[model samples]
Target: MKNVLILGANGQIARIVAKRLLSEQADVQLTLYLRKSHRVDDLVAINSARVRTVDADIHDQEALDKAVQGQDIVFISNVDHDPDNELTQGVITAMIKNDVKRVIASNVLGIYGEVPGEYGRWNTEMLTQAGLNRARRSDELLEKSGLDYTTLRLPWLNDRDEVKYSITHKGESYVGVSGSRQSMADVVVKMIADPTYLNRESIGLADPDTQGLTRPVY
Candidate 1:
């Protein structure tokens, strides 16, 4: 059995991904640490023996370290209004302590201009300057930590129905401010399936070309 640790697991995207993981393979066990008590009835309904939930602060190094023990894969979904960037740093330290090698982290697109042009620049600035320099600093530390990790630079997410999206590689030119966006579920699938993504690399995702969007691609 593969032990999976999911930070911010109560989130919409995280919950969606957890369900898919359950559907894909029962051998995957999910340990979700949530800061808030999200009263999602479906979460309680869907979780049986495969998924476990715990209320803990990612900022607490002792608690974080405890959570990291005996996990094969770790997913760090961003916390809303996460002030101190504790999760990012705590994840890295915890992983090192636990000897966990595979980490999948979510950051916003445009941090490095994976999406190019003015709009992409705007997007990057918006996230980077959104009152969380600690997050950026934490990410920088994670990149240099020398662990097998994948940093997903996700695009604007929409809660639409299931749809496949495109993965934006480094050096790609993002169109100016026009795109339908990727459903959160698809991004999670892409991240979990691709084990090759690592500390030095990032991938930006959006609706695939086959879906045919009316707006420009960014």
Candidate 2:
């Protein structure tokens, strides 16, 4: 059985991931870690034997450690609002203590400021430059933490259903400015089920041939 722990389980992406995992893979043992357990009552309603919910703050090292223990892989869908990447730090410490490897995290594009052309400048100026430095710091934390991690740097996320998307590596100049939330969830599920992405890598996800807007239009 593959033991998986999903931090920030109450978030939109994590919520989707939880349902998809349970529905798709019978052998996946998922522990959804959320700050507020009551927020996920709908999920618990599913009542699958392979599902577990944890209510604790990720910053609480002891509770985080307890959650990380006996998990083979960890996925982070949220982080604290601190620019110092305190949440990421807590996760790294807990994972190290529990000897857990393999992490998939949702990050944003332009963390490296590698988006080329006028769109790159626009992204850095009007879009990602606001308060996203904290996210970038978290990305840096994961990169140097010596864990087999994959950071899915996302573009403007839309609520539309699944669409054809493309994945780009770090320093490749992020393309396809927007991506569907379902597409991101699909990639996360793929990463969880397959072992082909064991090495540390940062991926940029987007649709094709379009410059994303400042925010997703519902």
Task: Choose the strongest candidate by TM-score.
Answer: 2
lDDT of 1: 0.65
How much is 148 displaced in model 1, in angstroms? Answer: 1.1
Question: How many pairs of residues collide in model 2?
Answer: 0
Clashing pairs in 2: none
Best by lDDT: 2
For 1-218, candidate 1 gives per-residue lDDT tens digits of 87888887777677777878878766788888877645444665676677777678767788888888998888887732367566677788899988988887776655554455455545656666654344445556666888786666555665556565556665674322332333655555555666554345655566554223323343
Q: Which ten residues in a row are the worst by lDDT in model 2?
A: 209-218
Overall lDDT per candidate, in order of appearance? 0.65, 0.80
Model 1 scores a TM of: 0.79
Off by over 4 Å in 1: 36-41, 79-84, 128-138, 174-183, 190-194, 197-200, 208-218
